[model samples]
Target: MPTALSSTDEPTPYAAPGRVAAARRAVGDVAILFQFRRHAVRRRHLARVLSLVFCAITLGAAAVPALCPGAGESVGTHAFDIRLLLPSAWAGILVLNMASAIASGGGRELISREEAAPYPVSPTTDHLGALVLAPLNIAWMVQAWILLGSVSYSMPGNRVVGSEILTLLWLVFSTSAAQVVAWAVEAVRRGAHGIAITRTLLVCLGAGAGAIQVSGNATHLLDQVPTRWFIVGAIDGWTWRWAASVAVLAVATVVAVALGAVPTHLAARRLPRDEARMETDQHAPRPMPRSVLGILIRTDRASVWRSVPMRRGVLVLAVGPGLVALAGDLKWSQMTILPGLVASGGALLFGVNAWCLDGRGALWRENLPAPATALFDARMLVLGEFLAVASLITVVVGGLRAGLPTSYQLAALLCTILVVTVQVVGGALRWSLAHPYPVNLRSARATPAPPAAMVGYSARLATSTTFTSLLFSGCAHVPDWRLPVIVALPCLLWSGLRLAGTRQRWQDPVTRARVVATVAA
Candidate 1:
């Protein structure tokens, strides 16, 4: 045992260089710590299994063309040469990645800043964590699938494998580069008048893109994009060129990863003025609602609109994919997919854990002299409205670019939007009641659920919504108008049954208490 020191004994001073070296050595350990904590807090066997299955599916999709080279060749003839569009596809994906990163405030966190406040986790760790979690977004995954499918279909037989490799490299490079840009954007947003400046910049960018499209220079501009070199190198099948491109992208990825930390450090040191302002704003009292349900609805709406994450998420969900559709000049058949994507993203914002939006206030809300069913209905109503507004905005934007749709196409699109919204709302409410998680959505980087659980939620939502969109897309081809209605009825009925079940469960005192206690914690 060591001898006890007197009051005169002083503590040893650590060398600055040694401390720095030690911190550098320990930076990566934070990821391991988060993983351990996550697994310990919740059993993730199911999430892991689902993740593996998804990976297998992604690989299988990519391998199809290689396994049977003649399969994609049998597809229907295209109106224009698909090869010329390859560069645009690549450039579009890169833009989307960057936009998503920026919108998400540098991507989702493995462990939120609030949760990690007691620890010594560094900004570098946060940057790494964000990079790791970036792939969980449904938009990112869907675009990646599209990229793979496009490359396999566009490239010649022998060059397909090499092109696919290059595409994968580009995906990695783009994601890393996007993270760097996102960190820089976050840093800027935390600066003076950051919100106004960022909003103005976004408007300018959108206006510029629109002007280019309107001027008929979209194709000419896309052809001149640097991404064309990747396709060209693949098509040429020149080993030296391919190797050089890979080497450059790899080195660039490393550079991006290192450069991202600088902004992360700067942003972390600064106060998030936008979030602070939103949280601290004083709202004047509104006139009282006649019914208890109306009061609850008002509160829920305010909760959603006030949250930084929800606002940013809604804006991104409303605009990002719609802009993509507009740029691509997607046909009515393709436009059917936009609503489902937007609705799913909207629901994931806070609906998946609806009660958590109230945080500890959920307990107070529950104690109010309101019927439990009224409370449930109010939450579901707000969620549905949120999803509907976001999805409708997306549809309206896409419609600007898509010329007049036939009656059948319009009917199919409308039914698809309504059905998908209902289905997503029902599923989200059911999940919220069945498996509630306490989430603080005040921060821009906060997810509505745990990262792993979000992965599962996003996967399920994406599958169902995508399948629904595809069905509606097919229905648009049919001349009969009643076909969409007939299909939508069953979907509505199924979702209604789900909502009824969730309501019944929520009405049970025991279940309600359990949910309230969990979320209020």
Candidate 2:
């Protein structure tokens, strides 16, 4: 029997009110997500964690004197040791990085990207609705306040705490200044060159500080240098050294900001679609050159050299070693490991972002004429270049002054270095591939990548550290062998991030309450 007009066959139960409500809910959900991010990025819990961390450090520092502080009056009084040798080596490495950047015309020159004429689009008018207007600004202010609070916590007359705060201030200048320079350079000069200029300037600042000591010593203007492989040595706090150093940094910051703000031809002629939003225009690297390596891989190396993200990634890993090594005073041998560590660390970090950076294009490549191996090889080559530069500057100069260990010892050390680095890179790659990081930035400063990215990186790092520690138990040469427990530890960090991101990508929208914008007027 024919049923009376079925509701399914006729118009379904749809209403305008429900549709409108759904739309509102979608927008609300987005707003809620943004609020959560604001809190996460601000690291509401970070202050507490940092307070505890610093307290532990301070207590340990205080105990040194009461417990078993070195009786030596000054670093110079001590014979050549790791402390003295490490910094000297780091200084050398920095000088080399600066020289390479300057000579290459910047990191851009080292790694090239396509360029084109700029569209007549104005950034100010393009974004009509909600956007991240001042992420960097918010972050910067939070960091400033954090620094102020941390320094305030140290006991009165604690020169170490004061010096630490000042160094952090310099970093603030560096990041801010870089933003200004990059903006101005892109505005006026345009093209990849503008980016290169900023990279070179930063590299110079980092390298120059270390090179100064070497130069002074070479010229006999200074009798000795300061170094400790992994720590910043005690500053004189007694006189104008801190003020002078601060003044120099301040001047540099001012100059960079002034130069950066001025508009340039570059602003009018940035790389066409390539420099625009990357997600909008993804392209395959041009054909491979028919050369020695190219003959084997059937690809052009230069075309695949993506320096910006990868190089910057490398720099992130390098930063820890770079800062730690930038100490004063040292012996002959301690410097060697620092450079190796820097180079390998950077490469591993880059690997995490590699597959993701490849995107669909990379996947296609993996499926086609070039395999993942090819891409990996080319990327590794790039890593090698960075390592050579880092290690050459770090190891050679530092090693020479710090003194090299016996050949076998050096080999073991080098092996350890490579292994650690590989472990780090592998872990980062696994993390990045499983999860991902936020690439879009309103400012030039490479703020913390997505929290997921960091979490992944940390997980991998921990795993890697443990594995390498255990595998090379004898080579690690640390005081204790128990540190390797991290290697075999089971974890689902990358899985968690991937799951969260996927859920966020697919979840239904919701309506939410609003909050006031928290940024400077």
Candidate 3:
């Protein structure tokens, strides 16, 4: 070039008329925009909505104390445990470090633009950019923390703060599972069992350690203060508790870091390309079913059974929430949590699948011939099966452990009513939130859920109102179980109506679509 083009230089009008060049540029821009739109829809938009939700919940729940915390003096509690503070700070530091590492490794790109020209590309630069982005992610996390922190403070701050170590441990384990799964998949795909073996051994060691810890806990060695020990830490309570916690955390961290390495590598290798393969490859299952509910159930099953990674995820999700309830019952001797917490959590854990999963591929299959009733029926049946089994277990355990017969009777009726209502409404909402485009067979996520937000909101509102009405209308202060008729009536009526609604609505495409979009959203 006799005269190199500069930023100030405007290109001459196309004398040769390069149509292909113009077309290429236009196409590229469109592709980029589409990717950006999807990313924005999933990341920025979703994050904002979730953050807002958390803030609202926190504020609303906080105000509830002023409204009511029920009879009996509410004893506000707190403890200054320096030992805990140190570990908590350390855990936070670890979180920041992990966040930075992920950011540098291109996880941030999941929600950002590609690098422009003039930026030097190197390992150091990649890490630097990630670290820079870390602050943004940390900010979001801090907002989230504030939201949850408020809830914990209002409900159980000490427990929540102490539980940070546990939460972090679980998060680490989750990271490990995700990574272990990815590497296992990739390893299988690439015919490399070596990585798989390494992963398996690490997992086994972690499991073995867990068994030992559990045994120790059972024997009271894990929760008791160690005698004949020189204690230098800033806390009193129990050296045993701290020792067990630290050991558990250390094990979890090791496992998490070991597993996190794979996903990081995948991101570095290029996530966009890999993600496409994940979403649209022939290697995955062929299209499952067309109906929203059918799709959701199938997807849920697939997540648990199809891939080794998702299977692990399902186990954790299905089991993890109940862990605290179990510990509480064991310690408190008040099976208040048995049916109330475990049953509901397990059912909801399985039930929420209907909202997002059921709505998958709704657009493409809307015209496809599929039985609406069967779709809804099958999904509810499976979910109900799980709930029924858990509920039975909870009821039996709760009945035995409850100190008062009246409490047991009351709890049983309350639980029965709640489970029945949940079965039907949960089914309907799950089936209704189906989005058409970018039909995710997995259906656990919504890139662009169909627009039934209003209906879904109404469903939740109605459910809430019914619950409040049942409780407020002389039910809340019922110290003894007298009106079994009242409890049974509401429970039975709600359950019947819900089931009827699901049966009736499934056949109506418009109704189903509206519900799917709203519920899924």
Query: Pick by TM-score: which candidate is best?
Result: 1
- Across residues 248-358, which tens digit of lDDT does each residue of candidate 2 receive? 657775565334323322343455222344335466777656644454343322322333443444444455344545444443234434543454345443344443333
- lDDT by residue for model 3 over 334-394, one digit each (tens)? 3323333333333333344453444444454445565666566666655555554554555
Backbone clash total for model 3 is 13
- lDDT pick, better of 2 and 3: 3
Which is the better candidate, 1 or 2, if ranked by lDDT?
1
Please give the ranking of all candidate structures by lDDT, highest first, separated by commas. 1, 3, 2
lDDT to native, each model: 0.83, 0.40, 0.41
When summed lDDT is taken over every stretch of 10 residues in candidate 2, the lowest stretch is 512-521
Off by over 4 Å in 2: 1-332, 343-345, 366-393, 400-405, 436-452, 455-521
